[model samples]
Target: MIKIVEVESNKDLKSFIDFPHELYKSDPNYVPALYMSEKHLLTKHPFHHHSEMSLFLAYKNGKIAGRIAAILNVNYNTFHKDSVGFFGFFESTNDFNVAEKLFEVAEKWLKAKKAVKIIGPVNPSTNESCGYLVEGKNEPPVVMMPYNQPYYHDLFLKMGFHKNTDLLAYLIDVGSFQDKSVKMLDLLSQRLSKRGIIVRKVNLKYFKKEIAECMTVYNEAWDKNLGFVPMTDEEFEQMANDAKMILDPDFCLVAEYEGKAIGFTLCIPDINQIQIKMKKGRLFPFGIFKLLLGRKKIKKLRVLALGVKEEYRRVGIEAVLYGTLLKNAREKGIVEAEASWILEENQMMNRALENLNGHMYKRYRIVEKAIL
Candidate 1:
């Protein structure tokens, strides 16, 4: 019989983090996360400030079979006014019996915590890389993204989960696509200035203050968005620290009007360029060399986050942000960029991207099921 075990000690938690290493041992498309990074993500990560989660492992006849985490986002529920729980950090062998036990444990714990509906495969939460690959199985996931076997989708569906919303990823080939976006950005920037708005590179000397401005806009602008959860000060700080290593100052821009921060965009070097060389997300001997050597070789970018504070909405701030990022990319000789995981219902952002010629290239889905 398969048995479900709660992760209680460091050793068990290590097993929970390392289980996927064995599960995907021979899968070429799979990339292993850094052992230490994942451990901290599970146990001591700053995300714990606003959310509570428990990790579990499933063993079948003494062999690891599956793993998952039950997440209770108190802040998310408070913001959305609903008691919705989440399941994330999920992975498993092909045995449905083991999978069922793992799922049941998360459901029971969440139910006891008073969660009414369960949604995800969110790794932790939507603020992080969230979703299951429902399409585009041939290409591996980009940096800081999730990848899984095609069969996992079947398992979730059989367990009664339905798609809540689909997330989109668009790809532009720098080598091929004519740079209409890049060419027009200067004109767009000038047009925006005439409208009383200006876009400028963020000043690193005031990093803390600028990030604070962003966090405030985030909380206000995204308050009513679907599956939106406000980031705590700790969470925002955690994210900032992670981005410091790869953030290009020019590529990170903010739009202002009369001196207050209103809109912003962050474009990160597709670390997948280096991540592919990373082998196992580590910084040891050869890893650092590969990263440094591959850094300049990175020609792709991910427009990681973009927001316009409420008062600045629908005033061409987004166009300015988009225009500015493209302009910086062109100057740096980088050709392609991805503005991703936009919620299907977020028509405003969608239109802004399409207006710049980005194509819908990849799709991921967030699925949910009520535990019976």
Candidate 2:
């Protein structure tokens, strides 16, 4: 019998967290997320303030078949007023029956909440990890990104899901991108300097204070995005603390207007390049040694997030951010980087990247289906 059980105990919760590891154990491209970190994300992350979610596991013939989470964000509905629900943390054996049963559980839970539309594979929400990894299947994901079996796409399509949005990931070889874009950047930046706009690496001494300024701009910058949810001070602080561990000050750049922060770009070394090699996703005993030793050898990065406050959207801040990123990459010996999860509709950011000669090497999509 295939039975779906709500996670009601510690043992069941552990199984839910460990399911993906077991399912992807044989896949070399699969990277295990840090156990402690995922636990907190699902359990104690401050996102719970505006959202409610529940977890479920599918068992078939006494074997773990799949897992999923049903999510309802009161804030999301109120903002867009779309009555949309989300399903995330999804994983399953390569079986149509198993996937249907898992998705049914998510659908049922959403229906109970009066959600009229269902969307995602969005771990919990877009404010965190979101999307189904539909392309670039040959390698593991960047740090804090999602990855899954290629066949999973067919599973969702069969389950009546269709594309709600697509996110693009751009790849740029550091030495090559800098070489190609440098001259134009140099010329343009000089133009920008004459207008009093300056590009520079972040100052660490007042990092926290700067983050506060950026936070105000962040909410304004992305306010027009689909499913956009502004972060609370607590949530931003927590996320910043986590990023501080691996955040390269050089790779995080800001654009100033008369000494005020108008835009920022942040990237981090793709630590998953090392994390996946660790196999078990631990940072102890041998894992810590591997992480420390492997950091320098890994040469890829992810341009994680970027924003230009609404008042300063056009003009040339994006190029300034990219130019500053170029300087950082040259200094750090980074060979390549991925600027990702760009919404297909975000033509503004897309044009900025293309102008820098970034190629859309990978694509991911969020799918949706209506139950009624």
Please name the candidate that would achieve the greatest lDDT relative to the true structure.
Answer: 2
Q: For residues 1-372, what per-residue lDDT tens digits would candidate 2 score against the true structure?
A: 899999989899889988988899888888888877888888888888778999999999999999999999887788776798999999999989988998888888999999988999787878778898777747788888889888999999898899999889998877876443465777778877887888787787898987887788778888887678887887777777788788878888888889988888888888898888775566666777877788788788899889988777667777667777886687788888899879989888888788777888888899998877
TM per prediction: 0.94, 0.95
Question: In candidate 1, how many Å is residue 329 off?
Answer: 1.4
Q: What is the overall TM-score of model 1 with all chains considered together?
A: 0.94
Give the number of the best model, judged by TM-score: 2
| Regions of candidate 2 where Cα sits further than 4 Å from its true position | 178-181, 184-187
Where is model 2 poorest over a 10-residue stretch in terms of lDDT? 176-185
The whole-model lDDT of each prediction reads 0.80, 0.84
